[model samples]
Target: MRLEQALRSGRHLSTADPTEAELLIVNTCGFIDASKDESISVIRDLDSSRRKGQQLYVVGCLTEIAEAEVRATIPNVDATFGAEQWDAVAASVGPASANFDIPQPEFTNIKQPSAYLKISDGCDRPCTFCIIPTIKGAMHSDTVSRLIAEAKAHARDGTRELVLVAQDSTAYGEDQGDREGLATLLEQLSEAVPDLPWIRLMYAYPGRVTRLLAETMARLPNVVPYLDMPLQHASPSVLRRMKRPTVNKSRESINHIRKAIPDVVLRSTFIVGFPGETDSEFEELLTFIEEQRFDHIGAFTYSAQKGTPAATLLEQVPEAVKIERYGRLMELAQSISHDQNREMIGQEMKVLVESAEPTTSADGSPVVIGRTYRDAPEVDGLAFVKGEFKPGSMVDVRVEGALPYDLLCSPLDFHKP
Candidate 1:
C-alpha cells in the first residue's frame, strides 16, 4: 500500500496488470521457505512473460535478506531494493509522462471497511528461530501524534475498523523511552477517531501485554478486546532454546490481560515443530492450547531460515515429523475454534460487512460476508449473515449457528451498544 501511494504521489500510471506497465515491480517476502518459494516463482513467471523492454525490479523483505541470492539466482532482475525503499522505487521508475496523449488518471483509493494502520516497523527481540529482526532491523515506533493523524485519516476515509499492526505491537514506544506508550497511543487514537467503530490490535508479543494496556483496551469503546499474541511454543525447554520468555511469565501476562478485559477474545499463534522438539514437548504445546482455549489459533510448522541461529541448532525435526505435528496442532485448534464459535451462537455482536455473496441460505435469504470484533481481517474467521448489507456498513447480528471456523448470523435490530 505504501508502494502504491508512492507511485501515485509521483503521478505514475498505476495498472492492475503487469503486462500493461513499463516497469514491473515485484515485492517479495523471504520470511520462510514457503514464502520465499512463492516470491521466486512469481518473479520467475513475471520475468518470463513480461515484454522485452519491461524492467523487473525486486524489493522488500526478500531483497533485504538475500539481494545477492536473488540477483545471482535470477540473472534477469534489473534492480533490487530493500524493504521501506518505496521512494527509491518510485524515483527509479522516473517521473510520470507529462502532456501525454492520454492524461494520467486521478488516484483512486479503494474503499475498505477495515484498514490496517501500521504503528511501527521492524523487530528487536532475539528469537532464535526467527529472521524478522535480521531482515528489517531494530524496532522503531511512530509518534503518537503521527499515529493519531493517520487514524483520523482512516476514519475520514470510511474505515469502520482500524487495526493496529506492528512487528511487536506491545513494544510500541520502548524506542522512545515511553513505558506505557501503546496505552497512551490507544487513548489518543480513541479520542481522535470517535466515529471509528472498531480498533483492533495484532501481533503483540508475549510477556509484554502490560496491565495498563489491557485496562486502556477495556476502557475504550472503539478498541475491541481482541489480542493476537504469538507464543511460538509452550514448552519451557523449547522456549529457552528459542530465547523467548518463560512459560510462567507468558501465562502471567495472559492472566493479567484476561482479568482486565473479561470479555476479551484471545487469538494466538504457535509453532508446532521446533529443533529437538520431543513428543512430550509437542504434547505440552497441545496442553497449553487446550488450557488457554483461545478464540482463534494459528499454527505453523517450523522453517529453518538461513542466517537464523535455529537453522544451525542440533536435532532439527525431520520434515515428516514436522508435517505430522503441524496437522495434529491444527486439528486440536480446529476443534477448539469450533467450540469457541459455538459459544457465540446466541450472542448479539456487531459485524463489519465486507461483501455480499451470490449464494443464499436454505430459506433463500441473501448472504453477506462479514467479520465480528472477535475476528481480524484475512487471518481469522468470518460471519456469514443472512441479509443484504452495504459493503462498508456495520450491522448488529445474532449468531444463529456455528461452523468450524465461521458463524451463521442474522440481522438484529440496532440497539446502539
Candidate 2:
C-alpha cells in the first residue's frame, strides 16, 4: 500500500493489467514454503507474459528473506527491494516529482466500507515455529497521535469499519516504554473517530491480553467484542518446544478475556502436527478446542520453514501425518463452530453489507452477503440475508438459520445510516 501511494505520488499510473503497465511490481510472501512457492509461481507466470521494455520488480517478505535465491532462480527480475523500501523502489523506477517527498498515509480502504489500519510492525516474540520476527525484525509501534490522524483519515474516506492489524498487536508500545499502549491507543481512536461505527482488532499475542485492554474493549461501544488470538498449540510440551507460553497461561488469559467481555466472539488459530508431536499432545489440543468452543477456529498444518529452529528439530512429523492431524482438528472445530452458530439462531446482529446478488437457494430470492461483528472481512464467515439491500449499508439482521461457519440471516431493520 505504501508502495502504491509512493508510485502514485511519483506520477506513475496504476493499471490492473500487467501488459499495460511499464513496471510490474509483485509483492511476494515468504512466510512458509507454500507461500514461497506461490510467490515464485506468480513471478514466473508474469515473467513469461512480459512485453518488451517492461520491468519486473519483486518486493516484500520474500525479497527481504531470500533475495539471492529469487535472483538466482528468476534472473529476469529488474530489481528487488525489501519491505518498507518504497522510497528506494520509487527512486529506481523513476525520478520523483516535487510532491513525491511529502508524507501521505496510504488509505487502502478508501471508498470501501472497511479499512485495515496497521497500528504497528514486526514482532518481538521468539516463537520457534514462526519466521515473522526474523523477516520483519523487532516490534515498532506507530505513535498514538499518528494513528489517530490515520484513523480520522480512514473515517473521512467513508470507512465505516476500521480493523486494527499488526504483527503483534498486543506488543504495540513496548519499545516506547508503554505497557498499556494498545489500550490507550484504542481509547484515543474511539474518541478520535467517534462517528466510525466499528473498530476491530487482530493478531493479539497470548498472555498479553491485559486487564486494561479487556476493560477498554468492553467499555467502548464501537469496539467489537471479537478477538483473534492465534494460539498455535495447547500442549505444554509442544508450547515449550515452540518457545510459547504454557497452556496454563493461555487458559488464564482466555478466562480473563471471556470474563471481561461475556458476549465476545472468540476466534483463534492453531498449528497441528508440529515436529515430534506425540499422539497424546495432539489429543490434548483437540480436548482444548472442544473445551474452549471458540466461535471461529483457523487451523493450519505445521509447515517447517528453512532456517527456523523447528525445521531442523528431530522427529519431524511425516507429511501424511500432518495432513491427517489437520483434517481431524478442522473436523472438531467445525462441529464446535456449528454448535456455536446454532446458539446464535434468532439473535440480532448488525452486518456491514459487502455484496448483494441473486441467490440460488430453493427460494428464488436475492441475497445480501455481509459480515457481522463476529466475522472479520476476509478470513472469517459471512451473513447471507435475503433482501435487495444496498452494498455498504449497515443493516440489522436476525439470525434465522445457522451454518458451520456462516449465518443465514433475515433483514429486520435498516436502522444504521
Candidate 3:
C-alpha cells in the first residue's frame, strides 16, 4: 500500500514484465528462510532478464533485515530501502508528476470483490521463530478515525467486502492503552459502510481475543463468523519454547470463540518440526487437530530463519523429518476439511463472485467462479458457481457437492448491485 501511494505521484506506470519497464520495484518478503530464498531468486531472475536501461530497486522486510548484504550480493540493484523507508524510496524514484493527485488510501488497480485494510503494522509479541517484530518494529495502529475513513473510501470504490488485517488484530488499541480498540473500530466501520456485505478479521492473536471482541462479531450483521488465529503448535512444551500461549490457554480461547459464535468457521495455521519438537509433541498436535476439528487448517514445515533465536537452538529437526510431519499433518487436515465441507452439501450460502471463466456445466451451461463466507481471498478454498455473473456480484448458491478444499455450488439467485 505504501508503495502504491508513493508511486501515485509518478508518471511511470506498473508493468508485469521487468524488461518492458524503465524501473522495477520488487517488494520482498523475508519472514522465513524459504521466503528469503524466493526473494533472492526473483531479484536474480529480474536482474538477468532486464534490459540495459531498466533500473532495479529492492524494498520491504528483506531490505530491512539485510540491506547491506543485498547491495553486496545483488550489485545490479540501483538502490535498497528498509521496510519503513517509504519517503526515502519516493525520493530515490523522483517526485510525482505535477498533474497527479493523491489517491484514496483504499483505492487500488486490482479488481476483486474484496479489499484488505491494514489497521496496524508491526508486532510486539516475542514469538521466537518470527522475524516480523524485528523487521517491522513495535506495534502501531492506525487511528479508528483513519481506519473508518479508509473503509468508507473502499465502500465508495465498490468494494463489497473488507478484510481487516494486522500483525495481531486482536491486539489493536493496546499500544494506545485502549482494550476495546478493535471492537470500537468494527462498530464504526459497520455504521460507516453498511453497503459492504462482508467484514472479515485476520491474524488475531489467540491470547488477545477478548470476550467483547467475540461478542461484537456475534452482534454485527456484516462481520463474518470466521476467525484466523495462527496457533503455531498444540504442545505446551513447544508453545513455551516459541513464546506463545500455552496449549490449555489456547484451547480455552478457542472454546470461548466457538461458544460466542457457534457456527464460526475456525481457521488456523500450525508449524511442524520446530527445534526440539519430539515425536510425542507431534502426536499431541495431531490429536489436537482431530479433537478441534477446525474448519480449515494450514500446516507448514518450520523454517529456521537466520536472525531468529530458533535458528541457534539445539536439536533442530532434520529436513526429512520436517517434510514427513508436514505431509502427515496436511493429510489429517484434509480429511477433517472434507468432512466439514460434506456436511454443508444441502445448505444455501452467499458467495461473492471473484472470477468467471467460460466453461460448460453438467447441463451444458456456463458458470462463474467465486467464494463463500467460509473462504478468505487467496489463502482459502473457492466455490465454483454454476451461473452467468460478473466478477464482484454476490449470489446465493445451493451447495451441490464438496471437495476437500473447495465447494461445488449451483446458483439459486444472483444479487448483482
TM-score of each: 0.91, 0.91, 0.92
Candidate 2 ranges with C-alpha deviation above 4 Å? 13-20, 48-54, 72-75, 95-109, 356-364, 413-417
User: How high is the lDDT of residue 70 in model 1?
Assistant: 91
lDDT of 2 by residue, 1-417 (tens): 668777766767567778798888999999877789999999999998999898999999999989999999999999999988898998887844445444444544346788888899998898998888888888899888878877888788778899999988988888899988999999999999999999999998889998889999989989999998989999999999999988887887788789899878999999888999999999999999888988888987888877789989988898899999999999988988889889999898888888735454567767878888999988888888877777678888899998998999878863345
Q: Which should have the higher TM-score, number 2 or number 3?
A: 3
Please list all clashing residue pairs in model 1, or write none if there are none. none
lDDT at residue 61 of model 2 (Cα atoms): 93
lDDT of 3 by residue, 183-220 (tens): 99998898889889999999988777778888988899
lDDT (C-alpha, whole model) for all candidates: 0.87, 0.86, 0.86
Best by lDDT: 1
List the lowest-lDDT window of 10 residues for candidate 3.
102-111
For model 1, residues 1-417, the per-residue Cα lDDT tens digits are 678777876666668778799888999998877788899999999989999999899999999988998988899999999999999998988767755443322323556798888999999999998899988889999888777877777777788998999989988999998978899998999999999989998998888888888888999999998999889899999999999989997898798889999878999888878999999999999999999888888877899988999999889999999999999989888999999899889999888999844367788867889999999999999998876888887888999999999999888863345
Best by TM-score: 3
Model 2 global lDDT (CA atoms, 0 to 1) = 0.86
